[model samples]
Target: MGHDQVVTSKGNDHPGNGPAVSREEFDALFEALRTWGRWTPADRGACNRVSPEHVRRAADLVRSGTVVPLARPWDTEPGPDNARPALHYMSELGDAEAPEPSVHKDFLGADYHGKAVSHLDALSHIAYRGRLYDGRTAREAVGSRGARFGAVSALGPLVTRGVLLDLPAVSGEKWLEPGRAVHAPDLVAAEEALGVTFGEGDAVLLRTGRLRRRRERGAWDLDAASAGLHVHAMPLLAERGICVLGGDGDSDVRPSPVDGVRSPVHTLALAAMGVPLLDNLALEALSAACAEAGRYAFLLVVAPLNVPGGTGSPVTPVAVL
Candidate 1:
C-alpha cells in the first residue's frame, strides 16, 4: 500500500501476477460462469437484466448532478501502448470558400480494439474456442463482412448504477503498479471498505489508478504486464449478477496466469457470461469525484456508436453524481 509496497508474484517472467493457472482450471471457471440459453434476444445477454425500475433507481442517485467523463482523450500520438495511433487530419481547411462562410472539417478514425482508446467491447468482439456468446459459431457469425450475431448495434444506450472499486485509495497508495492481480477476495474487501454493494444490473468499474500511474511513470507494454482481475474473480461477479464490467485495463492480468489463455477475463465475461466490457477508461477523475461525494455509486451511461455488424465502438462513457 505504501510507495515502496508493490504487488509482485513469482512466475517465469510475470513480475506482478499470481501463481500460474493451467488451461484446465481456466476452462472450469468458464463453464461455471457460462449462462447460455438463459435470456431472450441472446445478443442482449446480461443487459436484459436491467429493467425500467433499475434505470429509475439509478437516475435517483444523481443528487449533485456532477458528470464525470470516463474516457481517455483521442490518442493521436504514438506510444509504447498505442501501437496504432488514431488518425485525425483536417479534411477541408477554412481557406478557399465560395461565400463569406468558410468551414473546417476533420476526420477521425481508429482500430479501437486495442489498449490506447476508450472502447466498449460487445459480445461479438471476443470468441473463446470457436464460438461466440450463446453458442453462436464464430466463423459463421463473424465473417469478413462483420459480425451478424452480437454486433455493437444490438446494444443500445446503457444506463445503470455504477460501482467504483478504488483499489489504490483503499490501499493508501497513489496507484496500483502494473501486474497487480485483483482477485475475488479483493472485490469483497473493496465492497466493505468503500461502503458500496454490487447489485444486479449494475456496472462495476475497477479503478486501479492506471492513468495516474501512466502519467507519473511513462507508458509500458500492457501485453507484458498490467493490473487487472484474475480468472478466479469471475465467479463472484457472476454471482453478483453484474450487467457490465469495465476498468482502466482490458480486465486481464497480463503475461496471463492461465497458460495458453491470452485474455481469460475476456473469455469469461464476454464468451461465457455475455457481459460487455468498457476498456481503457480514464477513471482518475471519477475516483476523486466519488471520494469527494462520499459515495462510490452513481448513474453511469454508455452510448456506443451504432455501427451495424460492428464488433465494438470507440466510446466516452459518463458517470453522474
Candidate 2:
C-alpha cells in the first residue's frame, strides 16, 4: 500500500486492517525502505546511527535519576498469549553439599520470540525474499547454530534517547483495541499531545496499553488482533532515522494492513530498514513515569545478553529520567 492508502488510527473507524495489497506492492515498499550497503557492518543495521555523542546526550536526559524497567515479569505460567511459557525451575533448592552452607539455584530458558517474553530482535531474526538485512541469503547466513550475520551480539548495549508514543493517553482510552492499526497520523498526533518528536537514533517505543488491558481484562490471542504500526508508518520512521523500534505487540497490527503479510512492520523495520526491534515491552510504568515527569523522552538503555550467533536475546531494558 502507498501513502495515499494509509490507514488511520483506531479513532477513525478504519477497518482496523487497511487496504488489501498484492505481493508486488509489498515488494515495492521493501525496496523503497531498504538501507543496504550504507554502513560497513551490515548486521548492526540502523543501530550504527547511535554514536557515542548520542549516548552522552541520552544520559543527560536523566534528570530525576529514577529508573524504570520495561520488561514484564518472566512468565512461567501458561496463558492464552504465551503458548510456550518460559521455563524456570530449581536446580538446587538450598541443598548444596558445601558444609552447612546451602545454595539455591535455578535455570532460565525460553523461546523468547513469541508474545510472552520481552526481547530484542536482531536483523537476522526476520527475512524477506530469502534474504536478511543486507540481502544476505538467509539460508546461508542462518546456519544450524544461529545467525551468522545479524547476531544479537553484534548490536551490543544500545543507549539512546527514548520516546514513548502512548496512544491511549491521546485517545483517552485504556488501550487501543486489539486489531487496531496505528498509523503515521496517530504518531504525529501522539507527538503533538506528548510534546515530543522523533529524532535521529532515537529508540521509538509505541505503547498501546496492551499490558494495562491484560491486567484488567485477560490475555487475548495477539495473532488474531493487536494494536501496532501499519506498513504506511514506516516511511516517516525511516526518515527520522530511528536506531531501534519497539512495542507491546511486536510492532505489527494484526490482520495486517497488507494482504498475505502477518507482520509487515517487522518485515519493514528488520528486513528492509535494518532496524532492530524490542517486542513485548511492559511500558505501563514507563508511561506513568513520563506522565509524572511531564515529558515523554528519557534515557533508554538496552543491554541484551551477549549470546553469540543468537538471532535475539531476552532483555530487561530500562528508562531513566
Candidate 3:
C-alpha cells in the first residue's frame, strides 16, 4: 500500500485512558495491513523486502566499523515478566578421564518465548482469530510438530539498515514512564530530532531507556505496564515498509491500549502485515553509540538459529557503525 493509503487512528477513543481501538476497528486495521498472497507462498514474510540492493545500501552505513551487541544477557532468574528462567550449567569441567584434549562443556536452554530471553519471533509465532498469516488455520499450520509456515528456518541471516528511534534521547527523559504510549507523532518528532529517517526494508528499533529504568529503580511487572509503540503507530511503520520491528520491550505497550487485544502491535505486525519481530533486545549500548556518533542509522545483522519448524529462536543481533 502507498503512504497515502495509510490508515490513521483519529476518532476511536476507548472507554479508559487508552487508545480507542474497538474490536471492529482492530479487525479493519488487520484487513488493511494484511499481505496475504502478496509474495510467493513462503514463510519468510516481509523479509522479502530486503533485496540485494537493500543489503548493499546497509553495508554503506558501516563507516567507523564499531560493533555493538544488542541482545540482553540470558537471564536465569525469574521476575514478574519472566515467568520462565533460562538454564545454564557445565556439562563437563575438565573432569573427564585422561584424554588428548581437555574441554569444558556447558549446556544452555530456555523457554525463550518469554520476557527474559532475547529472541526473534517468526511470522508464525502469533495467531489471530484461529488463523496464522496468509489465512492459514492455526490448527492446521501449528501442531505439536511445530509451525508449518513462517518458521525461523525460513528466515535466515537478516542484513539491513537499522534505524534506532531513541525516544528518551529525543524527549530528554531518563526513561519514558511505564504505561506510556509512543504514538505516530512521537515517531515523527523523534526522527526530526535525531535527523534520521526510516524507509523501505529497514529494521526499526525503538528504545525507551528500559534498561536504564531497570538499573535505577529495579525490575517491575513489565507485563503489567511498559513503554512501547501503540497500535496507532502501525500505519506509520507500514507506510515506511519496515520489514523488522523491535524494542527493549516486546514492542507492545502493556495494559494494551487496544480494547480486548493483549498485543495489538504484535498482531498487526506479524499476523497481519507479515512482518517479523525482534523481542527483548538490549538497546542501551546502541543508544550510547548513537549519541557518540551523532548518527542513529547503522548496518544491522541478525542470525537466528536454523531450527526448522521452530516458532522462534534466541538471537544476538549486532549493529555496525
The whole-model lDDT of each prediction reads 0.90, 0.89, 0.87
Candidate 2 clashing pairs?
A: 64-321, 179-226
How many residue pairs clash (N, CA or C atoms closer than 3 angstroms) in each of the candidate models, in the order given? 1, 2, 2
Question: Model 3 residue 204 lDDT?
Answer: 98
Better of 1 and 3 by TM-score: 1
The lDDT, on a scale of 0 to 1, for candidate 3 is: 0.87
Cα lDDT tens digits for candidate 2, 1-321: 111122334322346665556778889989999999998788999999999999999999999999999998999988778999999999998855677678888999999999999999999999987999988999999999998999999999999999999999999999988777788988999999999998999999999999888877777778767888888889999999999999877998876767667688999999999999999999999989999999999999999999999999999999999
- In TM-score terms, which candidate is top? 1
Give each prediction's root-mean-square deviation over alpha carbons.
3.0, 5.4, 6.7
State the TM-score for model 2. 0.94
- The lDDT, on a scale of 0 to 1, for candidate 2 is 0.89
Runs off by more than 4 Å, candidate 2: 1-14
RMSD of 2: 5.4
TM-scores of the candidates in the order shown? 0.96, 0.94, 0.94
Model 3, 92-152: lDDT tens digits are 8987786768889999999998787889999889999988888889899889999888889
Ranking by lDDT: 1, 2, 3
Candidate 3: residue pairs that collide: 13-20, 14-20
Alpha-carbon lDDT of model 1: 0.90
User: Which regions of candidate 1 are displaced past 4 Å?
Assistant: 1-16
